[model samples]
Target: MMKLDICQSEVGTGLPSYSWDWWTENEANQFPQELEPSTWVKLSEVPSSFSFEEALLLCQCSPDSWLAWIPDHGEAVLHRSQFS
Candidate 1:
């Protein structure tokens, strides 16, 4: 299994963007997702304490920086040095 590398630039900040390609092109049903939009881990690995994106971070299933995240429709993506 290929581990997704969380993108961290020299500035240590990322512009998390929604990639329908990233979201769709990521997996081929290797793992069951709790949330089809962002989750890539198995359903049992999902943590109730964290958001789905956070779970992706903790699981290291993303290739984008912390700023790069899955966004709900109409939700705005802002520039932030810190997430949450």
Candidate 2:
């Protein structure tokens, strides 16, 4: 699997407020099969400061390739497969 280092955007009141910087086609494809395209939107309510372990499970990311900053939460390393 390919690993992607993404910078997460700040949270907003509505959808599309968060974006993953540096994610490529291959990296996006690495997401898990159980993930839906709309899942991210659904989970957008998750606090930005959430933990890496929490983001891993929340995003269903593989534990090795994921990394992001959740505003007040801090930062974490997550897996590409988690967002499938």
Candidate 3:
């Protein structure tokens, strides 16, 4: 399959209160249910400390690392970074 690059926003110095709950709530508003696994690639072996900032940093700092979607006390979703 043809490859595609993904674009994700960086937390930067803002969003000190960013957390998994915040993400899920916002997503819930947009999507009543989680998108199918095929819609978005989920990463593997996501770290327990996974955060959007951490994933972004990992992609920026360690390009080989996956974009991890780890919510505290929830299942983790990881994805290969095509843009990393």
What is the lDDT, from 0 to 100, of the residue 66 in candidate 1? Answer: 26
Report the lDDT of model 1 for residue 35.
26
Evaluated at residue 39, the lDDT of candidate 2 is: 34
Point out the higher-scoring one by TM-score: 1 or 3.
3
Q: Give Cα distance to truth, residue 31, candidate 3, Å.
A: 19
How close is every model to the real structure, measured as TM-score? 0.16, 0.24, 0.19
Lowest lDDT 10-mer window, candidate 3?
54-63
Candidate 1 stretches greater than 4 Å from native: 1-17, 25-28, 32-54, 57-84
TM-score of model number 3:
0.19
Q: Report the number of the highest-lDDT candidate.
A: 2
Q: Give candidate 2 misplaced runs (Cα > 4 Å).
A: 1-64
Candidate that scores best on TM-score: 2
lDDT of 3 by residue, 1-84 (tens): 999998786857564665443345555356423223223332333454433333331221232333333334333324343311
The number of clashing residue pairs in each candidate reads 2, 12, 3
Query: Clashing pairs in model 3?
Result: 42-78, 43-78, 43-79
**Model 2 lDDT per residue over 1-84, tens place:** 999998886666454334555556886667555543223311234454332223333333453453454444655444553323
